[model samples]
Target: MYTFDSFKEVIASSNKTDWDKLKQVMTIIQTVQESKDQALYDYSETFDNVKLDTLEVMQTDLESAYHDIEDDLRAALELAYKNIWDYQQSIKISDGEASELYQKVHPLNRVGVYVPGGTAPLVSTVLMTAVLAKVAGVSEIVVTTPPQQNGVNQAILAACHIAKVDRVFQVGGAQAIAALAYGTETVPAVDKIAGPGNQYVALAKKMVYGDVGIDSIAGPSEIVIVADDTTRADFVAYDLLAQAEHDVLARTFLISESKEKIEEIQRKVNELAGEQPRAAIIKTSLRDHHYSVHTVDKAETIDCVNFIAGEHVSIQTKDASSYIDQINTAGALFIGDCSPEAIGDYIAGPSHVLPTGGTARFSSGLTVNDFLRTNSIIALKKESFKNMAPGGMRLALEESLQAHHDSLACRMEENK
Candidate 1:
């Protein structure tokens, strides 16, 4: 594990490989744009090692997957769906009304959700993204994922059925993003795309931002556990390892003022990591990105946490809830010892798809708001138009937009 005396040194040491990957993703997207639907099949053979006859998953297959999933798994998906749907419903934007100005919120006509399925099937992601889109009343919710040797995972299909996704495509990587953005013979174009995946998919989303909306260019999973002498070493260790197991590039940080407590947490992390099923990944990630920082006080610790701007932050100190307001940047915050970061990933009311790699400073997690667009409404009576037109005409004339000024003048005259 690496030790940092200051958060500045940690930021300096961080490695960035997005630009290199962006070049490769751009090449793949260009190929997809040229080949259209054929590129998806070619990528499947090259990356997934499968020859596909059809690009879309049929409705019958989704029904079979629903039945094939075990009873307990179905129950779990239903529960997650309920929580996400309920939370999204409660947060719907209220229609604004006033004498001269109002606002209307409307769901996008279509949206595409990508679920990572190469090494592991991210079934939870299906619930986290699609359920919110459904609750937002999007007309169409299309899904895309990489296919396995046989096909897409049954659990993923079952989750799609439960989430009421309109369609599914057996495709992934930059090519899938291109298809969603530009449309093809089979995959209809979508207004926006949401979900997380590897570097390639992230770069693809970044590349296609203007053509279609995206949630965020999500980076590797990360977590920062802020604890002190009162914190439980075992809990801190396991949570760190849980984040580390996400990928070989995942990062975990421990911030505290007590040297002995840091050492104890590090020791527990080493011992518990060996017992995890993804021990190899956990070990590599820990050696590469893990950091332990010793701070002078709570203020310094909070500063370190804000600088890291981790995707998930778990505060395990005394009165953890009190620290929530102090944190200025983080994708998600878990207060108190009883709330584990893993719970937020799986069953929490908030969507698990969050900004990463210090992007929490500007971006936010996925929500029903992502699926809806707001439009400003303007309606003015003759008196209201007379009251407001001169100011607008003055601004338009100052900018030398003669057409804009003329249009406003013409309307005002007609009203008169």
Candidate 2:
């Protein structure tokens, strides 16, 4: 059912949409715009099945969360924090040394990070987003997530504590995005918003793009694995299943030159799917979204992989590193058999929040750079100004802007 003759066919067939669903999301965002805090409270009750007195997570609750978490989990969170912080620090923009014609990078005044919470707690997302903002020297980092009947997940709260988040609000979905885009009484409006969520959240971000900056409209998780006979079928199968379990919409692909290897991997996938805890989700994802392509050679496989432009790509060829240079359009590349996508998801020193739905062709994963804004420095000395005045005047005249030419002429007269 998932067979494809060429990469072009695969690209053409990647459409997944329902206009009615998007319209509903738009209506909800509009409602939030009208109602503000009341809309948030109503949505929390209607969708999340929780009645809340307040939208903000209290400071006492955050402290209790840190104390509530087990020692081992805290240690793991600390290690992840260190690795992510160190990696971000290493790549942070340094002060411009040039006297002119340079750019100065500075952190945003405030940012909002959305961590998804409902069935499961995404504590890692809290670290993946907030830690980068902290390392980028952001003055304020506000966190917003869906709350259970009791409150926000303790692990997420603990992560907030570790990342030194400035504020946490128990709100989610499109309403949460709307709240962040337009300030409510409880949640302060953010300069930019970052993090992943369901389709409604993605649409809300799309609607609010110009009002506030957004990271990306992330889709479901996806991975493409290019393997040869050397790669184990079981390993490939589990890798595909791992991504599939993320959501019923999540997709996984196996591209190989050997038909025999592809068959073996498919068989292993069926065998393992029955054993997974989230087997229903894995089954639906595999049935609807997963594909195994058989190419004539490694070159064709590589081209197909590039066309897919997956969020995560695992190359299990003889020399995995050899293919890295050719991989021009992937959110992240897992080089070898040992390098599972999980490593990058957890402690691989890169943010797991990546561009999805083939957006890797242009965009990239989340990083400290996303938290920064660059201002171009144009410091023209008197000599440089005089040298460029003639050209500036000529261009201004060519464009029929007398005022622009006069400004340059006046500056030249001052030099004279």
Candidate 3:
């Protein structure tokens, strides 16, 4: 049971809501900041409930981990790895080699990827982040994830093998970010850090952003569905619930012009929810932040969708692709009823780590783009500099920066 709202109210309230709690994570530092080994050990004891003397995962352990995993799950992980790797490789490019003009394109020498470890081993995440770094031509990629039980999950080790991570560490949470940013004895400092994690991990990355590059401080997952009369109630309900199951904080919304469709979908959702083992989570998420809106027409539905700026958006109406073209914001667009949100999560070939909490309005889903950095190349001949000097000086003069104007003025005099 969700409530409807006009776009204006939602926008205003979202802005006014307290974000201070979320901001605090960036400020909090792990107790192990001074010593990487101690930090890892402390977090291991604190979060994972295990104390370990060694932080680095040995290759022998990795090999044994492969045997530890079931064959079917291993096959599934391999399939996911191949799909993700194949897709990322297509986007990677070698720098425009030997250009006459000053040009340079290259991957960072080192990068770090963080994978969550706790409730479930996110084997797919290792494929998503590490594989992309390799495709982007990074020389070295390292993985940092918490230990589960006593050690890394077997699936996680196998994924690391698939991702070709140069090093693996059994550390997680804020301390992991700090170690990657500052460099522990076993973990070398990386130029950039990428991947998703819980609140503490997210906050740590936010805090260490200036010290090292990081992906977005992702918020809870969210999905918004724009369904028409042609939409199946079951399809709409299931798709919305996919993101909702991520966490209770995750949000889901459905906007339709037809009141009957909205009611029918709600009924279907209620019926299906009872069967879900995670039903309580879904129910609370829907009851709290989720929305079911009855718009006046398709125009209003589009407006509502844009305002929500959901991480995943599905259009179950006719001309779904055309509607996607019309929509300005959304992390990922699933057109038509057949392509549900579930496909995007595991095997869709697109990275499921998307912008969340309305960040899709400005940011984007994770991609090879996130793993690559572009440096602008610029050069000017003596004549070019002479020609541009007067304009540069005039702007600097307008801004009342005498030194800025003088640097160009002196350069022009030297050319003469």
Poorest lDDT segment (10 consecutive residues) of candidate 1: 1-10
Candidate 3: worst 10 consecutive residues by lDDT? Answer: 21-30
User: What TM-score does candidate 2 reach?
Assistant: 0.97
Q: What is the number of backbone collisions in each predicted candidate, taken in the order shown?
A: 0, 0, 0
Q: What is the TM-score of each predicted model, taking all chains together?
A: 0.96, 0.97, 0.88
- Cα displacement (angstroms), candidate 2, residue 262, comes to 1.1
In candidate 1, what are the lDDT values of residues 23-96, reduced to their tens digit? 98998899888899999999999988999999999988998999999999999888988888888788868678
| Candidate 3 residue pairs in clash (backbone atoms < 3 Å) | none
Best by lDDT: 1
* Model 2 stretches astray by more than 4 angstroms: 1-7
Q: Please give, for residues 277-347, the per-residue lDDT of candidate 2 as tens digits.
A: 99999999998888888887767777788888899999987878988998889999999988999878877
Scored by Cα lDDT, where does model 2 land? 0.89
Strongest candidate by TM-score: 2
Question: What is the RMSD, in Å, between candidate 3 and the native fold over all Cα?
Answer: 3.0
